[model samples]
Target: MRHSASFLPSRKTRIIIGTLVGLFFAIPFVATTEYTFRDVDGHSTIHWANVFDPAKQAAYRPIWTGLGNSLLLMVVTVAIVLFVLAPTMILVNLRFSKLRRIFEFFALLPISIPAVVLVVGLAPIYLVVGRSMGTGAWTLAFAYGILVMPYAFRPIQAAIDSINMSTLSEAARSLGASWPKTVLRVLAPNLRQGLLYASLISVAVVLGEFTIASLLNRQNLQTALLVVSRQDPYVSVIFSLLALLLCFLLLVVIGRAGNVGSHKKGRRK
Candidate 1:
């Protein structure tokens, strides 16, 4: 008891650590905000106002185009996580447990591989992809799906481990439920938190990705920010701040959704 208590942080220590971490992140955001508002004479809102000005639309067109592409990528990437990766994980966990190690290694291999290295291998494949698909930005989701697999895998695998997937799947099958029904009706509900977390992480990763998109010659939010930054640094910072806020809000909203879902399930039981 005493050993465990010693390992636990004191309230004051926790507060200090939290404050320091908060300041570490807050400092840059605050600095960027100030920089965005700064102009020749003093701080002004002209840059913020100009974002909505019709006359200035041409200047910000790339940002808008990139944002649209990123949103589409986010959706398609999430679908890959949900429809492709999640189902494969379910199959591995329930039916082919022997292959778990191999599946896990491949799922996590991307994390150890640097983005630049992945881009090299992806380039030739993308050449074929571009020829067949005509180089639309949405096709980048295939690469983003691979890039985000490590992050999306852990939460989902944890959720799978926490439950008796074999029993759940077997029971569903015995009840005259088809394979798709068992997966959709029995397995998926239990894995809601993991699915939600994986989708959210995929969205965040796709939005912030620059290296893959840039190397692939596709436009995304980060690439657009780069282009706009060369022309107007302030606008780029403003958009960066907005993107950060968006990711933060997405995290909060998805977290709340999970909490609310669990609460409802608890009450139902």
Candidate 2:
């Protein structure tokens, strides 16, 4: 009891820390919310209501377009994480165990590089991509794949580390399962939590990204907000709040799903 108590903070300390942390985040959100409700006359919900007004659709078209592009990018980025990164990681851990360190070094290299530096390196490559791919906004997913790799890698790697991949793969193979079948049927299910968390993180990163999209002259949610803010700042703030809320909801929902799965498994055992 004494040892456990040593690790736990006193109730007063917990309350003080929680309040400070809450204010740190809540203050800015509250300020932005207040700003969005303010108008030339007084505080009102006109800006909020105008967001859904059909007659004003033309004014918000850029935001809609950017949001659409961002959603597409999010899909493509998650696919890269699922189909490419996760599989490669599994292969490294199971087959090329010795290369795991080297692979991890490269997987995490992007986090050390600044976004501006990455854009500088990617600019020349995107020129070729634009030539071949016709400059579609979805192509930004390639860059985002790299940007989100470090974030995605951590959770997936932790999942990989938790399991006996070689033992599981060998058992599946011995049972007449092909390599592909073993990975898809036996391995992937176990890694679902990591994959889902990685996908969610990738979505958040792609949505919040602005520098690369702006530098590459691509239209995404953040860039569209910048463009719209020039005309109406309220709309931008409203959308920004919505994006934050969406991310928060995704995190909570995914976390709850993981917990539910755990509880079910526990009860079955």
Q: Give the TM-score of candidate 1.
A: 0.89
Which digits, one per residue and each the tens of the lDDT, describe model 1 over residues 15-38? 999999999989998898899898
Query: For model 2, how does the per-residue alpha-carbon lDDT over 1-25 read when each residue is reduced to its tens digit?
Result: 7786797888999999999999998
Clashing pairs in 1: none
Question: Candidate 1: where is the Cα deviation over 4 Å?
Answer: 1-4, 7-24, 253-269
Tally clashing residue pairs in candidate 1: 0
Report how far residue 241 has shifted in candidate 2, in Å. 0.4
The 10-residue segment of model 2 with minimum total lDDT is: 257-266
